[model samples]
Each structure stands twice: as C-alpha cells, then as structure tokens.
Target: MAKSTRGRVNAQGDGTSGLGMVVRFTPKARSEGVQQLEKGGFRVASSKDFRSAVAVPNDFDGADVQYFERFGIAIVRRDGERLKPMLQNAMQRKVISAARPERSYRALGGPQTMRLDLAQVGGVATSLDRDYLLGYRDAVNELVDRLLGKKGAEGLVARAAFDETSNTWGLQAIRAIEGDLSGAGIKVAVLDTGFDETHQDFVGRSVTKKLFATRSSEGDVHGHGTHCIGTACGPLRPTSGPRYGIAHEAEIYAGKVLGDDGFGTDRSVIAGMEWALDEGCHVISMSLGAATQFGDAPSDDYEQIGQVCLDAGTLVVAAAGNESSRPQQIAPVGSPANASTILGVGAVDRPFVPASFSCGGLNPGQEVDIAAPGVDIFSSLPDDKYDRWDGTSMATPHVAGVAALIAQSDPKFRGWALWARLIQLTKPLSSPARDVGKGLLQARGSGEV
Candidate 1:
C-alpha cells in the first residue's frame, strides 16, 4: 500500500451528524482497493464498478453506503473523527486517490422576470453574485499580446467578436457555418429539467425522452430545458424569429434530471448521464451545476465517467457556471464541468466580451475549455413561448450543438478528437484563457469537416 497522497480529511459539519464523501480510486487500485476497504469494515452501499462505490460505516464510527452511478460518486454519512482515519487508511493502502465532502448543486439560470409565456421552476436557490470582469483586463491584454506572436493567432483573435446588431446574435456569435451539415445522423442528449413536448418548433421532430426525477412527469413544467433544447436542436426555419438552433437535423434525446421545482440531487443527474451514454448520444449537454468556490476539487466520479464516455466516442459538455464577480472575483468551474475530460464552457457576449457573470478558471482540474454567446440569447420556452435569457447555461448548448455539427462533418471525429477539432476551429478572443478559454466556438463551412 502506498502512502495516501490526498491530504487529511476535514470534518465538514458537527462530528456527530451523517456526512457524505466521494472516494475516487486509481484505475489500478480499483479491485484491490474496494476489497481492502470492505475488509476494513466499510459497508458498500452501491457501485457501478469495483472502482467506486457509496460506502458507509457500521455506526457513527463505522461505514455505510448510498451509491450514485450517473455521477460515479458516493454519499456517506458518519462522524468525521471516525471516518477520517478509515479514509486515510484506505488512501495509505493505495485504495483511493482522492476524497471530498459532498454538497448540493443548482441550475445556473432563472426565469425571465417579465416573460408572460412560461412557467418558472422553484427551489432554495443560492445566488452566485459577484463583480470581477473589469479587473482582468490587463491579464486579457497580456494574453492577446502573447497570442499575437503565434502565426494565425492574431487573426483568430480579431475574428472572435460577433456582430451583435441583429436579434439573432447568438447564432452569429458562434459562427454557425450552417452549410448542408445539420447534424443529420448525430444523437444529442440534453439533460436538464425536461422538454416542452408541445413546443411548436419541434413539431414532427423525432425525439427520445426519459424521466429520471422521482415522481416527476416528462413534460417540462419549468422552461429551462425547452430553452436549451431550442438552442441546440430546434428547427432551422422556426415558426417565427430568425434561425436560432445549431443542429437542426440532430436527433434529440431529452432526459429530465431536474424536477419541476428546478432542483435535483446528484443521483438524478448521474442517472440521466448514464441513460444518455447507453443510448449512444454523441454529445451530452448539461447547462446546470453546483456552485463552487475557488480551489474546490473536481468530482472524481464525474472525471472517471467523463473519461469513459470519451473513450467510447462520446463528448460531454457542461456550463462553467455563473458565479463570477468579474474584475474582482472569479469562481471555480462547477462539478461535472470541472472534470478535465469534459468540456467546460464560459460565456461571452456577441462582441466577444466575457460575461460579467461567467466564471473563470486557473485551477488544475477546473479550467474553462471554450467560450460561446450567452447574453440576451433568444430561444424557445414552454407553451409556445420565446424569450431571451442569460447565463453560462446559455453558452453550453451552443458548444454542444456545434460539436454535433463537427461530428456530423466527419465521422472520424468523436470524443477527444472532436474536442480537439472544436478548440482548433475556435476564433481566439483577446480575453485571458481563464475567462474565454480556447476562444469562441466556430462551425465548419460547406464541404469542410
């Protein structure tokens, strides 16, 4: 057994209360690791593989279990004093690589204040309010200077800004090179609140639907899912308004992970993701996240699952979050999105300026991977509604839809290869890497994969 490389476990709450933690094991340590932990008296709750599980102690001092497969994370509760040493022992035995306390997650966007056409989801919301956009100007300038030295990089930066003069700015901002490639054969799954099956924009479109929320219906009571779906896979010539969707011909898979109340646990999220992968979705777009503070570690379960998805030719994209105070403070990328194997999308306006609410990243496992238009973006809502909303939530599906287009462009591109194509095709922005990442997403043109 190697010495545990992870730091000492800290008690999250009163030592007497049940606490949840996720233990991530190295690939090589999986089998031996679970065996050793079980032998040490830890109770195995549920697991997707021998590599991970929801473990618990026999009592306040022993282990118990509650397993979550979608996120590949575990939820355990017990006195920290009793739990730490056992986890430390597991680490020392080379059974686990890292461990962290579990917390709740939330949706990144909200209902339009003035909209009359849609219903809103409710929850005990946590606001990620801050102002930090102006402070990073110098860092962005310095990055632009460095980028200018590379061949073609300056041109890329110059082309990053989009024409915001029109109402369909998001479409133009992503540079959707819509030319024959309508994501024809690609399967895209959007895991969120649910879908508005009655939305006219999707009339006659083929869709695969699933409900993961306990006791919840598949129809989208909250409008978030419909709005996101509108951006990623809506009709090319919508009933009204300019063309808003990116992959008009894509096969839509709507998985309702969040309930009508706009809240969900990791269990539901993980279930949705598993369903998406099992259905062979080429791209999975998650516009929701649990808000996190700076330096928070990425989820080990999600990292492993993301890597597996990539290995199987699936690409997962999630919102970087809307917690930035812009120029003053920048929050870390949120869970699922924080996984290095998944693409984390930050928000920029039509002019290629970083959204004041968009999160930035410099942490090892929480870097932002790309940027997309998110502000004042128009898309479909429930009950044949249409409205413009804002959040990194809006930015995520743009990248997902474009990824679908890229995948449709060339059969050879999938998983990490498709991820690389996205970065390579981006028009570099003058913003710092922590803000806008590789730059704004760009779709391939006609006859170009």
Candidate 2:
C-alpha cells in the first residue's frame, strides 16, 4: 500500500506543457465574475460551484486581468516572460490572492516492485500499476496545482516506506479519558481508498461505502483506507493483537476518493466530501494531503467547503502532512487541512514526542491542531491483514476516532462546539503551538462531557 508522501513542483518555464489557467472567483462575485471574464474574451472551460473556473485567455496582454469586480485568483501556465507580468499585475491590483506559473506535481513514491493482475477484477482498469499510476498522479497533481495550489493541498502523493508493529499505542495514548465512551450513534466517514468489504474485521460492522475514483473498484486494494478505517472504527476484540481502533461502535462511511494506487485528484476527493456531508456524517477523516512549503496560504475552495461543513454541524479532520525532516527542513500544514476551519492533525509517538516526519505550522493558516500516536501504530489492512505505518496519515484517524467519542459524549456539541471541546479537553504538551495545537488529544470520560 502507498504511504503519505509529498508533491514537488517544477517552476521552470514550459509554455506548451499544460492547458490554460484556473481562476477562482470570490464568493460574492461568483455570479458576475463569469460574465466579466467572458466579456473580456476569456474562454471558460468549466465552473465548479461558482467558486472556480478554468479558462483560456484570448489576449494575455489585453485581458486586463486585474480589473475583476471582486477578489479572485488566477494560476496561469508557465509562458516564460508572458506569464510573469500577468502575475505581477494581478498581485499589484490585489485582484488575485497569489499568482505563479503553472507547474506539474510529481509523486515522491519510488518505482513499483510488482504488478497486480487486473483480469481477475473483470474489465476494471485503474492506474494502480507503477507506470500508469505515476502518470495518473501527474495529472492529478496538475489539477491540484491549478485548482488548489501548493499551500492549499496535501496528501496527494505517497512515500515508499513501511513498518510493522504488534502494539496499538494510539488507543492507549487517549485511553486515560476514553473510559466507556464507544462512539455509538455517531457517523464517522473515512475518505481515502476503498474499504475491504471481505475483510473479516469489518464483516458484521455497519459500513456505508462509496466509490468516486475513476475505473476504481469498491474494495481497498491500496490498503490506505482499510488501515485508516481500522484506526478510526476497527473492532474492539480483533482476531489477533491488542485493541487498535478508537470508535468501536461508531457508524462507518467509507468513501473511496483515492484509487487503489493511493493517488487521486481534487475532483474525486471533493465528490467524496460532498457525499459524506450529504450523509450527515458527524466527523469526516481525511488521511491524505499534498506537500506544502512554509508561508503558503490555504485553498479558498477548501476553506469555504470546510466553513460550510462547520455551519452544517460536521467536523472535518485531515492530516498535517509528513514533509518535515526536523532540525533541517520543516514544511507547513497541507491543503484542505490547511484551511482555517478544518482541524489539522500531527503525528506523535507513544512517549508524547512529536514525530520527526510530522509537519508544523510555520505559516499563518498551517498550524497543527492536535497530536496523536502515529509512529509504529498498528491497524487493520486489506486481505485480513495487520500492519504498522508512520505518517500524519496514521495520526489523523486517531483524532477522528476521538472526535467521534467526543461527539457521542454530548449530542449538543457539534461543529465549532465540538472543535472547542476537543481543544479544551486535551493534555497540554510543552511543545509550541506550531507543532501541536492545543496538545495531545484525549477522549471524554464517562462522567465528563
């Protein structure tokens, strides 16, 4: 299975590499902004929820890109000298938040060692194979950069690392206050690869599954979703090993946004989010993200989506990303998770020490909300298997599971109230807020709400 990895950008000028730019219109100006762009001779491809549009500029110099009605954003293709001035003009007029030449996102995951036989799965053909998977990842990265940009997205790539463990330290980390709260009646959604319906661990569990990735099946061949679901809602008494899951009794909504190769575009992810929200899920756990540098802003689309979810009484939690090498290079929180309204989770060890791979909040909107046991954490996988992995991906589900427990503790606590309660009930660590926001997460006891 693929582990969470970072995405890289090639900023070199390559004029003919990609399609035209992507323009994100302001919330209030969405209706009129399209008209304004169209009148200016820009060829609009498609508009997503009136928030963003992909267009080809008719006359780059004569377009007057800065004269839009409201605050908007444009991500143009790398057209050498032609692109730089447009970016400068947009930035100077403040019409767009930021502008940069379009670049491709490359997955850091190394080469594939084996290929799976797709024949057995019927005529299903996905990019799970090594070469096709990389190409698919490239396209997804380009879409993400055009739509969300570097700072606005995370968990789009996966690293080539894995480890095994026998103990479930994540459950023990928050067990002090967990008590008997079993997350009953709460709807927890895990949006990643598909789930393994045939897995013995989840045979009798209540799971609502959906597939959004292209040409992808309804089962988890990538193992990312199954592992995350295991941490969030695995059984209390498993076939082997100690208890690893958090919300043992919570309802599971498994939405397959990422394909079996552990890669997906923003379209699939957004669709999965919409499905989860429509289902009235109390908590949505996204253990995926793209890499982001320090001092990068969050994506406007994701920010708006998160705020909408909050208003609708649902909490979205995402991984802060694993791009930091510590003491040398530290990355900021990744997109979707970087959104101010979204809860960003960082990884920690059983000893309460921040993981070396966990990212920190060096920028304004990239702060980590809380920490959870991610290093060598044991959880369920596909094929009735168990494995341990390390990444902010592993840590995110712990927080989600705890959020389920918290939401179940007090029905009145929803959205912002639930966010506030989780923050208030944490075990404060001595680390800086940039590293661990509030501190390590803790579940509510039987008597406490």
Q: Best by lDDT, which number?
A: 1
Error of 2 at 181 (Å): 1.9
Give me the displacement of residue 13 in model 1, in angstroms: 8.2
Provide the lDDT at 264 for model 2.
62
Candidate 2 regions exceeding 4 Å error are: 1-25, 28-167, 176-178, 446-449
Error of 1 at 186 (Å): 0.9
lDDT of 1 by residue, 309-334 (tens): 89889999999998888878787787
How close to the true structure is residue 131 of candidate 1, measured as C-alpha lDDT?
17
Query: What lDDT score goes with residue 449 in model 1?
Result: 32
Residue 61, model 1: Cα distance from true site in angstroms? 26
> Residue-wise lDDT of candidate 2 within 133-244, one digit each (tens)?
5356546645654574332101222111211243366776665234777788999999988788678877788888877664567688888888889989888778888778
